[model samples]
Target chain A: MERCGLYLGCNIPLKAPDIEQSMRKVFPALGIEIVDLDGFSCCPAWGTAPSFDIDTWLVVAGRNIAIAEMKGVDLMTGCNSCFGVLSEAKHMIEEHPEKKAMVQEKLAKINKTYEGKTKVYHIAHILYKEIGLEKIRKSMKYKLDGFKIAIQPGCHILWPTKVMEVTEKNPFYPTMLKELCEALGAEAPYYSRLEYCCGMGALRSTDQEKSFLLVKEKLLSMKEEIDPDMIVTTCSSCYLQLDGAQKILKERGEIDFTIPVLYYTQLLALCMGFDAKEVASISEIPREEIIEKIQSEERAQ
Target chain B: MQVETVNLTQKDRKAVLAQMIEKGGGNLTKCIQCGACASVCPVAITGLPLYCKRLFRFLQTGHLEEILDDASSWACVACNRCTEICPRGVDPFHVVFAFRRIQAQELAIPASATTSLMNFYTTGHAVYGDASELRQKVGLDPVPPSTLKYPEALKELQTLLDESPMAELGLF
Candidate 1:
């Protein structure tokens, strides 16, 4: 089995451990061994370290990459922000010796050195590219036959393709997530606002009303066009925002319908016959119906 | 909304853009005002006036101080659509971040950001929420295999941050 260092940036491990549980359940079943990157810190998140100082950002990110380097494995994360920021840091450290020196100097204090060897990948990329859809389909215990899913690929995984390790051939139209869902027999249909931001990170934190406007519009487009069974996202922040926004919109009476949201791993866990309560149940919106539907199929080995 | 007139002769305006370019926004000089970045920017789609296109225009014209306290840059999610679609390769996202850095240097950051910064130093998680119960419910270790579970590692992270320029900010 191929091995990778599982780098759980802040959210999935803390606020949304169910997503972590899903990842734990899904990867092992897919024949990928999860090597925990012990002592990993946050990807240092853009708003915090990055906004303050780029050097600080690179050092913190380098320290995380350094842990994986000691393990001699590539780092894989479910967080698009972690995947993006760490990937960018790796790129910057690789391209600029001065920046690498700065990072190395700070890292020497911690007794760690990052030679910029580790590659960062989002879980979607690993599932799509490294694992291959054919192996994924074979490993699934249940298929999402006829179930329609609206995908939110999340922005960080797609853009500034120059820095990102995993990118869609046409980022304007991302199909990696869609095709991965199809491996489970689900029809991952395209909606008009598929590429629209979910207004998660800094947008949601800065102005809720303005952020909600973007999510509201995206939700409306999803509701009107495809009307899928659920929404699946690649980013934890997007997963939280898209899932939580539905409840906020319902309470505000802005949107009449609700679409349950899941990080792609949670969806994959359910397809792999893991208990939904463990891997998929923690959410603002109830996913019982979707869970029941997927489990309704005959169990496969 | 009242229209505030910009003083074009203000010498600090060019310095403001220069600092931004120096702070990871090297492509700030490449913007052509074509609005291609704006076309796909989340800030624009959400109807923010100081979106990339306008922000670039404002910077190009040396109107930095006027927009210093605007808080529009804080609203960026860093989607990088502006970086992808910009015809001139301006990398509008980096410019936006550089502007944010400028705001941060001036202590014009939002209070929430201050809180997150403090949290990052203390706990290494910017958006930390106690999920011990959740992790228990999910049949995993309550403390994840991160800085939280390792005090020495957390100290290592703290030392790295402490030695960096952020320590100069005194937020930690």
Candidate 2:
């Protein structure tokens, strides 16, 4: 795709604008034009429309897809939930004529129709497939050769593979994010608990204490094995959860050490020469140490 | 071992089953009480007692009330790992979601989730956390071309939610 529409789901706009800002810089620098998808709404989020009403879920998510379909460009998003919900709805409406008619009737109330011609692309897939890692490596103004990066591709990015536009080689053991990190000259080694959820979303909202169980385990696993300098996630929710939880875990004396957590685009933008504050700032956990590490790499280079 | 006298006929288990099946939980009865979904469940692994097979059993025996007040069902993150792995193609995730839709009606949901849904209903975003100033710091448009920036579009979304059964139930 020469140019794809950018679908900024709620979180990236409200809680994590840095991800949006980072993508704006990174995508353009990589020579892929990102069109602004005006008048788009929420993916309606999994917790919202999806849980209560199926029609609301389909119509709201379909409307978001309709925006891009009208533009005649595949919609792309950095948020995994958006990728999952929107893509899954697109899959259902396209497969089931009844569902498509149902959703179309709802859309027609608002004077719209879903053609289902537009594909949904997650940033990880877009970066891996459309924008090749080789191109990213060559475009890099900085390298993470010495850095040990722990990648969180997030749960939605992998599961319900039917709706996903790009399929991973092995969903059980996904290497897409790790490969993307390695392409940036970083070490993204395999860990046993890599495929596990970050314990964010509905789980965290209902039971915060229990939610930390997964984060703690994953962190300890990473600490025991990779001892990564930073944790990078492709999902905004994972980015928020991991980054926020680590600091609180450290503060409550439940864990030791602080690892700077960033959305993948934040790191990519930094390597492509975007300012650290613009892309990687607004972090709940401090970026001082990681920024120092990246600066040192630049100096060494 | 205590001998448990199981009587599913006393309670309206069939009625519950009918509702579930109507809402795409038809495969729920198709559950052979397989423990695979439970074993692979991300929440169950975290000690939440949210097993897919067990959940179906609860509904089978009209035990949803036991789990209603608790946060057990609400904690489901909907990763669908079980759906992808289920040998019966039960799509345990859909079954779980069907129950959640019911729970959303009868039980009090988590405040954060409710707040998010309300925000989505009004503003077309699950989050209203201020990042416009942050966007300004990063030299981008403050509101990012969403319903937050467009009132007309938000009206369209609000109309969808207003007509939803959740609205008729007055959840918001």
Candidate 3:
């Protein structure tokens, strides 16, 4: 069995553990053993340490990455921000010796050292690249044959490809997530604003109204273009924004429609026949209707 | 809407540019104000005036103090779209982050940002909540296998943070 450290960043384990539940159910079933990366800290998320200083961000990220190194396995996370920070930290270490020395100086006090040994991966990237679409297709108990999913690969996974270990041929026109959805037997299509930010991180933290304007625009574009049955994304932050923002938009009369949002792993867990209550039940926007739709459609088939 | 004009000579453009490059925006000197970054920037698309392109121009011209308190830098999502599309390899995301570091040093941060930062220092999680109930509801351990479950590791992280440059801010 292939093994990797599971670095559950802040959001997945705290605010949105359903995404955690989904990954817990999905990966083991798909043949990857998730080794718990105990004592790992934040990705230091973009808004926090990264906002303060670059070396500080690198040190925090280095500590988390060092934990995975101690476990002797590559690190994997369901959050794009974690993936971004960890990947960028590793990139900085490999690209700059001085930065590595700075981080090492701090890490040594905690009995840790990031020798640039551990590789970090996004869950979606692992599923698409390593798990292979054929393995995914064969593992499903219920295929999304009749559903349309709007794919949000999230910004961290796509951009500054030079710093990333696994990336698309053309990130601006990424098709990996769509193809991953297709492998699950769903129709994941293109939209004009597909590459746009979901306005979740620092933007949302700075001003909710301005942030919603971006979400509202993305939602409008998704609604008009793909009219997807749900929005599937790789990042937990995107999952939170796309899922949680709809109700607020509706209440504010900014958008009349609501679309279900799922982290790709959650949808995969559902397709793998995990119970809905355990893996897919938690969301701000109700997913009961879509869950029923998936099951009812599966029964009819 | 009032348009604020800058007297470039009054601003310390050289100091701002040097600080930006020293912090993390080494590519700041490479930006050509081509607006390619703004063409896809969420900060610009969402109508914030000081998106990457304009911020780069401001920093290049030593207008740092004028925009230090501006919330526009805080609004950057770190999407890196500007970094990807930049023709001159400006890496606009780092430039924005560099500017954010400057703001942070000046204690110009928003309350919510500080809250999350303090949360990160204490709990090893930036955006934390009591998810014990949620975790159990989803059929998992009440506490995740993280720093939350290991006090010693949390202390170790706190120690590291205490020794890093972040400690200078005294936010924790």
User: Candidate 2: which stretches are off by over 4 Å?
Assistant: A296-301, B1-10
Give the poorly placed runs of model 1, Cα more than 4 Å off.
A297-301, B1-13
Error of 3 at B17 (Å): 2.1
Alpha carbon deviation, residue A144, candidate 2 (Å): 1.6
Give lDDT tens digits, candidate 2, residues B14-38: 7888878766677887787878888
Residue pairs whose backbone atoms clash in candidate 1: none
**Which digits, one per residue and each the tens of the lDDT, describe model 2 over residues A89-145?**
888788889989988899989987787888889988889999998999988877888
Q: Write the per-residue lDDT of candidate 1 for residues A1-301, one digit (tens) a residue.
A: 2989999999899889999989998887888899999998889898988897888888889999999999999989999888888987888888899999988887887789788878888889899988999999987888888889999999889988998777899999999999998988989888899999989889888889999999999999999999999999889988989989889999999999999998899988888888988998789988898788778745454
Q: Global lDDT of each model?
A: 0.87, 0.84, 0.87
Q: What is the DockQ for all candidates, taken in turn? A: 0.77, 0.73, 0.77
User: Native-vs-model 3 lDDT?
Assistant: 0.87
True C-alpha contacts between chains kept, each model in order: 0.89, 0.83, 0.92
